[model samples]
Target chain A: MTGLADRRPEEDSVAMPRVSFTENLKRHVDCPPQDAAGGTVRAVLENVFADNPRLGTYVLDDQRRLRKHVTVFVNREMIADREGLSDAVGEGDEVFVFQALSGG
Target chain B: MTDAFHVATRKGLFRYERRNGGWQAGAPAFLGEPVSAVLTDPRDGAIYAALRLGHFGQKLHRSRDGGTSWEELEAPKFGAEPPPPSPANAENFEADMAARKAAQTVDTIWIMTAGGADQPGVLWAGTLPGALFKSKDHGESWSLVESLWNVPERAKWFGGGADLPGIHSVHVDPRDSAKLTVGVSCGGVWKSDDGGETWRQAGQGLRAAFLPPEMQYDPVSQDPHRLAHSGDTVWCQHHNGVFLSRDGGESFTEIEEAGPSVFGFAVATHPDDPESAWLVPGVKDETRVPVDGKFVVTRTRDGGKSFEALSNGLPDGPAWDLVYRHALDIDGTGERLVMGSTTGNCWLTEDGGDSWICVSTYLPPIAAVAWA
Candidate 1:
């Protein structure tokens, strides 16, 4: 019998990054987890936008830049590169996108 | 049913239909979200709802089948991040950056108005943080009207409800698409004669009692709580008093005798009768509730010279429900009027304010209402 952690090399190259949304964002649209195929954050978001195009508008500004209040995290690290969203993402990494609305 | 309408409340959006001399409430949409503004386009019969979610900031939804189903659309958002701190504020770049970031996020869409009948896909939205946005592809996409946003007078304006001032009313000329007027809370009314290419302060004669003696009559400092336009005249339920403009907002003169108290949030104008209007009077600004704890609606057929309190079927007991600016509306014929209060009650009159019927008793805090 083979365990999940035991299967490594062959599955590595094909592994996709998992993208999830906050509950707040989920109410606006049906955001189910998806395995995005991309090496960079921009590419991964583009893949997600491909499925729900309108979601991109809520997260991105007209100039195709991330809104000031919206934050994207890669494996619990807040994104530092906002202009291009070019932060690198590796296989099996979890990417989270959520709005940073503060106060009532 | 002769007419249909929708009411946007703190909890959701509800549609009301009049069938066989009775009114019915439809299933609520966006069931638990705070809907700030909602409008229906007369040209194509599309419904737009603006909601501010606790965690998601602000969002917009559109329904083509008259509120049966909804599709989320891109909300009106600032086009880009504020230009890097200007040379003047470069010394305090961090503070400047913080301020600019706050300006970009929309706290709410306070007002949504359909464009003229000719402009089928046109829609106008005034948002918190004091910006005006226009959509040309129906409600599909929006672009910020930077000309008005960049006006020099905007600096003097501050927030009335939220931390930043917001545009609460956008009135388009019934005759031309090129003419438009907007009422800003804390900021006075501004008008555009060239279809938003240029804007000018149009609040002359309106006084702000809270301002310094010398600045009391300064147009830009006057806070217009609610504004309505009918033909060539513009009417305002101001923070200080009721004001009327007879020359297309060129100037306003306070109508010193508008009953109960001049302070109110909701103002409605007859569709064809320029001199006819209605207002739900409240206590003064400090209290901002009903006067004497009684909910009364004042109507003026002679253009505010004198107002008659209309309370045929409304509560006369110790009730204190404040009507919001966008919560009062009149249908096209001006015979039917409806208003909702902050305490989750609505009243409707079908006989031009002669009598009123309680439409709903328990609803979410009403934010806005419009005839569909």
Candidate 2:
């Protein structure tokens, strides 16, 4: 599986996905507005991690897969692929990463 | 002005700096996040904070400039197990079950202890689900200590606070860096004399009242609320009572008369005096509070033969503050001690428990306190 480090920008510019993290995640990491360019959900996330390396480990596991407690939504729908994170992404898509912070 | 103490509370991390003649509370770090453990690396002045976000899992952050700023780092993560082979039949059921058990995430970094003087950048972290992690690059990276996790006795361990057992104490012998001891909740004292290459149960004489009479003496079933290392002795304020071991945790001797109630969470051992240790006693496990609703701290100067209740400047009535396992600590001078409680109250004593002063009374439920 290709990680964020190996992705190359396409010749035809793809609309950068706007990535945002939950407030709980922002507490531990520096999460600001950033545009991620990719064709798939995995690529956009890899782009997000490329800008902020540490956040990757928080949202994904060592296997480069989404963490169990982490949820990622593409536009209005939750991504169906967790293992591959290969859900397709379109230009202008907004990716939302939610970390369920509940209970004591 | 030296910053001598730090408190890890449910809300955040607070450093107590000694200014003029008293300790002053500094601005909080990781504000509004629960910090379970905090340790200052005396060798490099780096501060490591273990923050547990209920939704995002546990994380570790380090500050090289006292508590000025922090950089989040990779937390200890259990190795992932590969998916089981196809064909869900009885032949592969056992292997499937074992693989699932190997991939548990670290729910919390329950305890953090710096390595000895000669072992700079070497640190040990204990976590929930009862696992150990060691980092050689300060708090930058960590690798699980699989030898201790694979111990056969671990199968029987269960959590005291959550559904999974957790490790709350990790003590490295100052005299010998390779010799280490760990205290686990629902599990007993464990020792690794060969730098964690191997481990063995060290609760030979520790007792648990909740166990069956015949199982009371079992080694792996002991619940040690807190463990403090002083000189060559290891002092444990267990769920049942106080215990002491002089021979590196090979065996423990219960101190029957070591408290006003014998049930509490926090315990601190003087850095230079092995005989002097402190404990804050609550009513009992079920009714965890001050005895008769009066707060007091018990001290022992004669190796736990007897205990003296210290309440000079503390609340005297209807005060039910319960101190957690890591909320009490003694400074390097062995004279100044600081303790915080679940009720958001903090106290300090510069005269070795002879008297006390309120440090703060409205912070947050303190989870850990360390005198750096």
Candidate 3:
């Protein structure tokens, strides 16, 4: 009901996490816009957080330089300028997460 | 982690320990310091201890008739386990010297378990990428079972908890050798059938609760920090809290009875009974908290059907630090228990956690400890 109440036919939709997803490493977070304006990686991610606080920690950190284990790809190739927000974001970009991969 | 050390909960943790040592230090907790030891033969009141893995892995010191005298267990001909064949290994000083020490350190028989389980074979030394090299012939020539490596999920190895492919605990059910379980730091609990010939990821239901968005697996710990078998249920001090599994990890039920730190490590089970176990929570921030421990040892009297917090004599109020599972133990005598924490404190209970005592206050973030 909360999701529906927030929806407006004149506006757009957002991507939100579902409930009871099962897994201890989880927190409640809300939706992201289906379409947003951002020609850069940080811009799009920030755009995600702008509408959903849940997407904040999931994408960016306190220092906000991509965590070593976290990888962001543009067309399946790894990004080089992980720090700068100047990296170009083309149409239909995708993000993938892979933790630092600790232990043995 | 700076203060993490070992605590010999009782004379039942491992099959080696001096009869009279204050605070009962068992198994010489390593990585990289061990202090105040009394390795004894016990029968003839003969005390002998091997304090080789000492500071900087430099020398091997042995003591007879307690810590009153010392000897060295080094043989010129013997060599440490060979390096993993990395030329870069030479660049790493600790690696080269450590390799030499590990290879040469086993020349003379010091530990009672060196003679095998029937004799003195309680501690099973393991290596990275997960290998079970047993010294059944009394540390003469180590044999690699390679069974753990062959398990289908071998690729999932260990990296989360403690950041290493770990074979931390080797549990032998005296009633049945085939009924064995080993705790992989981050990969969770693994059970071997037919003497470790085959293994299955018994921690299926254990989920990563606070995984970072970038985290592919739970941080360094296997499903949780530790695994203890109580009847059909395998309880653990998970990355989340106390968890229970029935049907040999085929399914699970989380027991909400855990914490001193919601973000911590280590979980241990009692020796004789299925209903008993222990956990030491870790403090998250840079500051150290508490004295004995934040949330002390918690146990389920009836196999986790129910649980109660056991903080009778433990450090209470304003405490923070991560206490691992391997550091907590219930002695074989069935009357005692203990937990070693990163705060440089070891809490003891000779009455099954009904009460507590801060026995030892100087040990590292304890890795593993056993009592004989």
Candidate 4:
């Protein structure tokens, strides 16, 4: 029987999505590029936040809604559900987070 | 008189120290950021500064060793649960949802005060969108005071100068930590006798001239810009005029003899004398400049029976300085007072309000000043 360490590299990459944050956000909180496993935008972000709770505050509000000044994109397209964050995310997709231009 | 004071401004937090017999400003902390509120905890000398960042949301920092360094702390925040529907708007589900959404987020930390001297490490903060929070272990963590937030009368509170109503004043009775009072813009005043376990509307005589004649005396509709206390006597710089309350905040009597004009924001009450208080007067409403472009500080020594305008060392007419609600502060001795204005002007009065000296003509627009 094959163990976990014997899994192929391609299988690992296809099971998770890549996530990145705006460079400017580093000044306030640390958010490094990494891979998170989730099927939807909310699930992916929640996975990341589960590791770094402080970063979540800078991106979302008390209601768990994306902050008015923060924007998220999945696979180069902006996520339409800011409040519920119901947008779908595919494995190996690139998720980018940005601070809205108006906030600056 | 105190040897140091802190000034919260649009750009940063400034610390002014009495050096060589004169006050001198040191380098600022949080420079280039909007310092909304600064609390110099007299009990332990811990300084907490609240910052309102355009993109990062409200942040709080505490400096244990003066303002030399700071460590960011968790700011007050509401929970995920939406507020209970108000009876006044229960029929309109859409409007109720909008109100709950607006109340869930903290906009700015308007004011913070240390708990009673006995309750060390205890801190109380009031925030915009009108919520109260308490911290029992210094500034390490905070929890919302749900009892006050859920009061039925809060539904009637509306905005005065901001889009959402804010609790700008929190007065914890020096004699008893459990007894507390808070002043809200457009929400009159509320008092909690059991350390915030419960609350009730308290400002009975506050009047709102801007409202309809029938609703002018409605306690929930009154707008109290600020509240200062001298022992048990409370002084309110209301939207319409200055009011004095002898029974804490149960009742108030409008002071009709304020110098220049009765409309202004800041008020400093003498720590030792209940009858003595100071006010900065300006034209009311649309024109918020000094009355006729003349800036003045009004002092009432006889329980608001009369007022004396003191402007010996201040700038001449054509000066358009309007002091915010927390910009003027009186030291513990009640003799030294510092006042800052919206136009970046700061004045220091060493002998009460008899004379003043311009400290800085260009600092940032001042938000609050407190003796350290």
| Top TM-score model | 4
* Docking quality category of candidate 2 according to DockQ thresholds: acceptable
For model 3, the stretches where C-alpha displacement exceeds 4 angstroms are A1-104, B1-123, B210-221, B230-233, B248-251, B257-263, B283-295, B362-365
Q: Reference contacts recovered by each candidate, as fractions?
A: 0.21, 0.26, 0.00, 0.50
Model 3: reference contacts kept, as a fraction: 0.00
- Interface RMSD per candidate: 5.0, 4.0, 18.5, 3.4
Name the better of 1 and 3 by TM-score.
1
Residue B121 displacement in candidate 3 (angstroms) = 4.9
Q: Give the per-residue lDDT of model 1 (tens digit) for B149-192.
A: 99999999888766889999998887998899999988899999
Question: What does candidate 4's lDDT look like per residue over A1-104, in tens digits?
Answer: 22224557777556577788988788778899878889888889999999999888888778777888889989779998776677899977778988888766
Looking at model 4, the pairs that clash are: none
- After superposition, which runs of candidate 2 have C-alpha atoms over 4 Å from their true positions? A1-19, A31-47, A61-69, A79-94, A101-104, B1-3, B83-102
Output the lDDT of residue B363, model 2.
Answer: 88
The per-model lDDT (C-alpha) reads 0.85, 0.84, 0.47, 0.89
DockQ of every model listed?
A: 0.24, 0.25, 0.01, 0.37
lDDT of 3 by residue, A1-104 (tens): 12323545443333231111111113223432244457766666667557764344333332344433445564355666554434666544444333333310
C-alpha TM-score for every candidate: 0.87, 0.87, 0.54, 0.91
In angstroms, give how far residue B110 of model 1 lies from its true place. 1.9
How does model 4 score by TM-score?
0.91
Worst 10 residues of 4 chain B by lDDT: B81-90
Chain B TM-score against the true chain B, each candidate: 0.95, 0.94, 0.65, 0.95
